[model samples]
Target: MPFEAEEIRIDLMCRIAEDGHWHGTLGLNVDAQALWRLGLHPDQPTSVVNGPSPPAWWHTAGERYASRHAVRRRHDGR
Candidate 1:
């Protein structure tokens, strides 16, 4: 089935861990059907692969994290 185009917004918050690693909370606001079409479930965690050269926004506080990490979905929060 063809997927419908919709506007989605995601917000993320990053923090430095005790080991100096970066971790964060990701929030996604999208339609459930749209998410399914993208092979993603609203109740499961999702992993993202960062390329060698990512956007400048991905880097913060001299820390370049998110090389490859999983983001969990927040029920009743998104």
Candidate 2:
């Protein structure tokens, strides 16, 4: 994801729900101790539930819909 804070990064463990739909988000790595002490390697899944990134078209469509609707989910997804 492109943002003003380029140094900030997060690793989102993506997964598909039971509704036969895929959902996942992979962000840039921005950590030092997590890598050194925790050994959380960048660009690597720590578990077998590794999922791929969503297609670009999916993102574009989402953006379009959200823009037209002007709706956003809260932090708790509500």
Candidate 3:
């Protein structure tokens, strides 16, 4: 959310899954259009799902900034 891209902004929408888990929708704002994608794949394999940004000053070589903004899923006790 702290990216310097003014032409594009990412917005997240919270939702509850059928299994009672919380999920978020990743949205891209471009030219007054809201394009959205959904998922909670936070591992390394899905790293490019939302695109990658350079690591912050405090991170190491293999570290990335996009890792901080992951879609957290929660389970509801029935």
Candidate 2 wrongly placed segments (more than 4 Å) = 1-49, 72-78
Maximum-lDDT candidate: 2
Angstrom error at residue 52, model 2: 1.2
* Residue 54 in model 3: lDDT: 40
lDDT of each: 0.55, 0.57, 0.49
Error of 3 at 54 (Å): 17
Tell me which residue pairs clash in candidate 1. Answer: none
Top TM-score model: 3
TM-score of each model, in listed order: 0.29, 0.28, 0.33
* C-alpha-based local distance difference test score of model 2: 0.57
Ranking by lDDT: 2, 1, 3
Q: Please provide, for model 1 over 1-78, each residue's C-alpha lDDT reduced to its tens digit, 9 standing for 90 to 100.
A: 223345466789898878786878888777765655444655545563222333465455235444355554643343
Between candidates 2 and 3, the one scoring higher on TM-score is 3
